[model samples]
Target: MTTKPYFLLCFVVGLSNPVDAMYYVQPWMLAVIIPLAGIREGQQLLHELYLLKKKSYAHINYHIGMFGSSALLAFALEFSEFLLVSSTSSLTLSVSGIFKEVVMLYLAVEYNNNQLNTLNIVGLVICLTGIIFHCILKFHALQKEKPVNTDLVVTERLLLRRMESADEWSVDGDSNTRRTSLDD
Candidate 1:
């Protein structure tokens, strides 16, 4: 088979395999992926470290530290994403969530993957629709938006307004304080 078809078949199978493992395997055992991930990341980190050490580039130490920190953060996020995908009941939903994430990354980086065939375009649309629908449903849950309090007046004006008009009226009706200035 061609590479694209093979990749698509493997992707579908990978998505399916996770579903079975998610249901039958213990949650704690799913953590095995983390250490395996660490091994993979560790290899990449070593490569970066080697490059940083060998190159007589400016800010070598800074690059090394940054690479280390980013690898650490990537590890955490990878584990978290795995947990999310495993906990989700539907493989399609989880895959779509990942698809949306990739689209967001593409938008943020302005990188063209250039594999945008009709099917990829259709999948992107479905992923975007799912993400938007999920966001809308979540927003709808908070039918009444809560007021936010902040020290900055100008920036938080909208929040203040929300607070002021939160309910029909205050139950106390803006009563005066019982304590006088002398009480202090």
Candidate 2:
């Protein structure tokens, strides 16, 4: 019933697909698309010329500047997201997106003076609590799965000891009597 195997299979298929290599050409695609989009927008603006005529030259220039700046920002954000997904994992990207939303919500509430009703506040708290618990569980899982290094290195002055089986030492035995099977 679990989707984990399906997800893994999809991931493997995605990696194996030769067409996926085209994702690396995203910058080139953007270069071609942006100019085409700009031309389309320019045509739309010309079609709506009457709306532009009422605005002063300075006002038009300021709005155009703001639009261009926002477009550039959008490009930067897209590129960064592409890099993030390429470098890390989809799960990391999803987690970061959630974190970004949380931060934006907090900023809106604190700096923009946006109001959240009781239900919204409660939902946000629950989301944060879930994220915290997820991180704690992931940390513990990783710790448990880590491979312990049992390889021994010899040096001239230092001696290394290896413990025997877990049941070798009896818990009820006195400290002096407690020893590993290797001691015998």
Best model number under TM-score: 2
**Stretches > 4 Å off in candidate 1:** 1-39, 52-103, 106-120, 139-141, 144-184
**Window of ten residues with lowest summed lDDT in model 1:** 2-11
**Model 1: per-residue Cα lDDT over 20-107, one tens digit each:** 4334444565588778877779887677668876657776768779879986876555445545544432343445566757866686
Off by over 4 Å in 2: 1-51, 130-184
Model 2's TM-score against the true structure: 0.41
**Against the unseen true structure, what C-alpha lDDT does each candidate score?**
0.57, 0.61
What TM-score does each of the candidates earn? Answer: 0.30, 0.41
Candidate 1 whole-model C-alpha lDDT, 0 to 1: 0.57
> What's each prediction's clash count?
0, 0
* Model 2 pairs whose backbones collide: none
